[model samples]
Target: MSPSHLLALRPPPDIEAQVVAFREAHGVRDAAAVPHVTVKARSGLDDHLCWLALVPAVAAATPPVPVELIAPRVFPNGSALHLPARSPGAVQLHLDLLDALRPTRRFGYEGPHMTPHLTLALGRRDVNLDALLDAARLAFPQPLTFTATDLVWMRKPGPGGAYQPVEGWTLGSTPDP
Candidate 1:
């Protein structure tokens, strides 16, 4: 069967540590998964060959995008809390990757618009939403900025699997390695 995969930009070390700490404090699962801002998620492509084709295209067309984490925002349905990310270059990179992978038609979210975010917590009915929001605000008060220099290819072997890094391509640099 075809593997499930996603393209993402991983957070820098310090920010990643904070995300892990928050997850641990709140008893969330999948804490080992790298903290990232997803570009495209769970595509239809089945194998590395397609990824092999797509990664080079993405790297060739993308430059290093500057990413800035803005304040925390809740998903409209209150299912998750996230840190909104802003970067024109990152948006453009998303569009370009979408174009390259258009044939797979694997884009998960519905929209002409993509709201890039770094998820802080998954909402649960048992948890007090307001309290979680307050804590998230305090945990991530200041804006954090970084250069999104690489695209990571992540894969899950089967249903309900943890995503693991398969490969990576550096933006505006040598071809996929």
Candidate 2:
């Protein structure tokens, strides 16, 4: 299968280090992965040109987004623990991207209903939700605040491949080659 592509916000190095440490402590399978809030989930993005064309314009229109991860919570299915973020700016960016990439097969989560979060443990059904939640609370007594300055184009080679950066665009600035 072809690699999947995604768009995400890379937090500052310090914040990322913290998240990595937390993930490692919690036994997350992707412990060494880059900590990010997925703005667009994995997909073929067959309209690659359309996304590339629209990103710069939309980015230029948007400013650095404020991302505040409030607290840790488990999904309704009792799997995956994440830190839910409240970022109106990020949400707006997501909506703008979706509209700009119109007619493309909408993949993964989309629209205003999507929650921006930093995944600490993803797709781990064997974890004890309550224990993990308690651990997260203790690990993060206060909210983590940061500004998302860049939108990264992430690509994963094949099904189990790690997502790596293909390119990035600074919010409100032009994209870099």
Candidate 3:
């Protein structure tokens, strides 16, 4: 089976380094992976089809989104740790992409229910989550704001495979310097 594809915004290098350090300190295996906020998750689609759909969708997307990474929050079941973010622009882009790619989309988009976040780590149920949360609170006491300037297309070759970047699109009128 072909790998799934998703659109996401990666964090700036400084913040990304902090995220990597936190994950490594906690013994997470994928510590070196990029820190990103998932804009859309599309499953059951091959790379070629996803790319064809993304090209036009990206063209219509809004310019670079201003994002603020707030306090860390866990998922309902405490399976993941993430920094909550506020980005209306990102949300609009997501909705626009959904509309453009609806025909080829295999799953329903989150739409208005989307909660934008940058995942820090996925923890096991047996782990001491309270400690992790406390550490996270200290590590991310202040909010960090930055421009989300690009949308990255990522794909995994198969189940359990790591996602690899396939292509990218700049968000604003100005291209990357």
Candidate 4:
């Protein structure tokens, strides 16, 4: 199968470490995953020319986003835990990507449905969410803030494959007209 693709904003190393440590403490961490907020969800953009042509323009047009990762909470399903991020710029970028990459779009977590967040743990069974919430609060007692300066293009070769970054672009780096 052609690799599935997604765009994401990576948290800074320090913040990433904190999240990883919290996940490790609870034994729910996916070591292969990098801590990130999904700007665009999974899609079937298998053609390199498609993304290579699209991402540069969108990223250069978008400015760096300032993200504030607030309280950690589990989804209503109780299967995944995440740190919700507050960022208008990120949201706009997501909306822009949805329009630019409409052909390959497979996920609908965009526009009004979009919630920019960093997944802490996913697909765990029989875990106590309340305990996990408490632990997350302790680890991140306050909102973690950072400038999201780049967008990473991540790929997973097949179902159950690890998502590894394939390329990246610095936002708003285009010279002024």
For each of the candidates, give the backbone clash count: 0, 0, 0, 0
How do all the candidates rank in terms of lDDT, highest first? 4, 2, 1, 3
Could you list the CA RMSD of all candidates, in the order they appear?
Answer: 2.7, 2.5, 3.3, 2.8
lDDT of 3 by residue, 1-177 (tens): 666677788888998899889878877653215688878776433556744555444643468889999999888877678898899977887777766666444454378668888877766655666788789999999998999878887776776565667777777654333
- lDDT (Cα, 0-100) at 44 in candidate 3: 30
- Per-residue error for 75 in candidate 4, Å, reads 1.2
Compare the candidates by TM-score and give the number of the best one. 2
Show the colliding residue pairs in model 4.
none
lDDT of 1 at 40: 71
Give the worst 10-residue stretch by lDDT in candidate 4. Answer: 103-112
* Candidate 4 displacement at residue 85 in angstroms: 0.5
Better of 2 and 3 by lDDT: 2
Q: After TM-score superposition, what is the CA distance of residue 136 in candidate 2 from its true location, in Å?
A: 1.1
The residue-by-residue lDDT of candidate 4 on 48-119, one tens digit each, is 655567877889989899999998888887756788999988899898887887754455556756889988
Cα lDDT, all candidates: 0.74, 0.78, 0.73, 0.79
lDDT of 1 at 157: 76
What is the model-wide C-alpha lDDT for candidate 1? 0.74
User: In model 1, what are the clashing residue pairs, if there are any?
Assistant: none
- Model 1 C-alpha RMSD to native: 2.7
TM-score of 1: 0.84
lDDT (10s digit) by residue, model 1, range 40-127: 7665445645555766767766888789988888888887778888977767777787777764464546224787778776666665
Off by over 4 Å in 2: 47-50, 175-177
Candidate 2 has what TM-score? 0.87
